[model samples]
Target: MPRKLKVFRTAAGFYDAYVAAPSRKAALAAWGAERDLFARGAAEEVTDPALMEEPLAQPGTVIKRSRGSAAEQFAALPADRPKPKRVAKARTAKVEPAPPPEPAPKPSRDALDAAQDAIDVAERDWRKEQRELAARQAALDRERRDATERHEQALADLDRARRRAQEDYDAGLAA
Candidate 1:
């Protein structure tokens, strides 16, 4: 099995890595090597340094060799077992048609009517709920629009007031 090293960067300045070694020691070694490579400015691939810690290195997160090309590693990885062959059903002459599925028992007329009534009631309630939701959404939209318009009007009023005050000041100075 070809070994794979997955590497990415974190937002911080430190180099974070996950190395899926053949053993835990190998993984630790890989991480140390990556840290050294980063310190020496020899590593090209780096993810956020924040990824180096617990959650990133925990169970499922992938952190391996951040310095090498992931594509090259993926290409280099060996293929597993070959896919199983599909057996053709038509080639087997002993095939017989499957038995038809048994029909479900039908309910009595009164039971069917009651079920239909229940369905109709449920449908009506669903439609009512949909209409209520639509109305609520529309109301919320209207409220938001009104709030925006009010904010704009208030800003305009403030600007006008400031301009008037400035003009009054100028007139007083002139006088």
Candidate 2:
């Protein structure tokens, strides 16, 4: 059987989140609230027909309506704000200039020192790794060059051995 749905409203940050649900638990589920918002007095069943329309139309879906933005809230404030009081002073009143503000205390350099130290350590570690990588590259290049030299030498030795064997065979045949 289909359960009867009711519109529920709650304050979500600066906006109001509304939903049509069968129960308070269903409403909380729609709002994705882990705790009981109704128990916390943050949520309540909305009876206002004007506020209920949108939520009832889309049942179980959360509808966020802006209460007021920061600027709008300030604009909504009462325009009859108290004005600054005007003091009656004689025209000959000599107003002494205020003393210069004292120099502010120097800010702590501990955080800066720690950050610099961390950067220095990082740089040192990076340079160490770069040097290790360069050394490995140099070793690899040397090994490659050595292998090429050995290969050429082996080829020359085999060629000479073959030529000597061929010459000996021709000499024996002639004899």
Model 2 — TM-score against the truth? Answer: 0.41
TM-score of each predicted structure versus truth: 0.33, 0.41
Winning model by TM-score:
2
Task: Give the alpha carbon lDDT tens digit for every residue of 85-173 in model 2.
Answer: 99889789888899999999999999999999999999999999999999999999999999999999999999999999999999999
Give the best candidate by lDDT.
2
For 69-145, candidate 1 gives per-residue lDDT tens digits of 67865776788889999976776578679999999988669988999999999999999999999999999999999
Per-model root-mean-square deviation over C-alphas: 33.0, 18.9
How many clashes in each candidate? 9, 0
lDDT of the structure predicted as candidate 1? 0.62
In candidate 2, residue 54 scores what lDDT? 97
